[model samples]
Target: MLYLWIKAFHIVFIAAWFAGLFYLPRILVNLAEVPPDSVAERARLIGMAQRLLRFATVLAIPALGLGAWLWLGIGIGKGPGNGWLHAKLALVLLVIGYHHGCGVLLRKFVQGLPTHSPRWYRCFNEVSVLLFAAIVVLVVVKPF
Candidate 1:
């Protein structure tokens, strides 16, 4: 019962976190494309990016915490035939890495030194979708 509740919240928070993950890069895309002369627009976009990143970080804590509780505290899926969990964890790490990458890019943008083109950012935005799809498969199918 407790495990089920934890898992439910974990899923909820993860979904929320992914929402930020999906949108943040798009915001970066907009930021990258902002007209250089539009100082007000640039400032607005930067502010939006900063707030979204912080909100995403907040969402991530509970998602990760609930995930840890389910895995380490409850031991809900930590036994034989559970290789899928390991794979899922690896992908989760990649998602975290992607999250960190977003922060790095955000910092670069905030400094007015963004190096990536809008096209590059557009491509990067799809990364979360691919990772999310793979993660869903690992969790639901548990194919191992």
Candidate 2:
């Protein structure tokens, strides 16, 4: 029963996290297009991205904790070679890194400085999307 609940949380959080990951790049692109002089509009977009990010973190952190518990705490870590588990954990860490990178970029944006070019932001977005997709595939297929 507890495992089922944890799985549910994991699914919901993964969905939310991916949605934010996909949308944040577009937000950054839109912000870049806005005139520099339009301080108010730029600030609005930045704030929106930040808030959405806050929600993503809220979902991700606990969902991760619950997943770990569902695995380690309940002894679900008995798979062959533990290959599937290791891959999933590595991807989860990558996702966490991406999450933190987004926070750093958001902080830079809040400073009103264009630290990342439009192309860089786009690449960041694509990488995050691909990593996330890979995670989903690993989880579903469990290809050892």
Candidate 3:
């Protein structure tokens, strides 16, 4: 019962975190397209990006904590023959790095210095989608 509860909340946090991850870059895509003279619109988009980045980061902590609890305390993926678990952990690391990368991009936008094109951002936005899809597959299918 405890394991089930932890797993449930972990899923919740992961979903919320991924939601932030999915949306923030879309906002960046808009930011990139904003005309240089459109001050109000750019400010509004930057504010939105700021809030979403903070929200996603907050959710990531508990998601990662609960995941650690499930792995270390509840032992969901301990011991030998757990290569699938290892792969999932690696993917998680990548996603975490990506999350921080979003913050970096947001900072660049705040400075009026986005280095990537809107098309580049569109491609970057899909990265989380791919990572999340792989994560779901690993968790559900557990095929090593």
Best model number under TM-score: 3
The lDDT of each candidate is 0.94, 0.81, 0.94
For model 2, how does the per-residue alpha-carbon lDDT over 36-89 read when each residue is reduced to its tens digit? 799899989998999988988887877788788878888665867658878888
**TM-score for each predicted model, relative to the true structure:** 0.97, 0.90, 0.97
Clashing residue pairs found in predicted model 3: none
Residue 14, model 2, lDDT: 78
Worst lDDT 10-window in candidate 1: 108-117
Model 1: per-residue Cα lDDT over 1-144, one tens digit each = 888899999999999999999999999999889888999998998899899999999999999999999889998676789999999999999999999999999999888784689999999999999999999999999998
Angstrom error at residue 49, model 2:
1.1
Candidate 2, residue 98: the lDDT equals 84
How well is each residue in 11-86 modelled by candidate 3, as lDDT tens digits? 9999999999999999999999999999999999999999999999999999999999999999987777778899
Q: What ranking of all candidate models by TM-score puts the best one first? A: 3, 1, 2
Give the runs in model 3 whose Cα sits over 4 Å from its true position: none
The collision pairs in model 1 are none
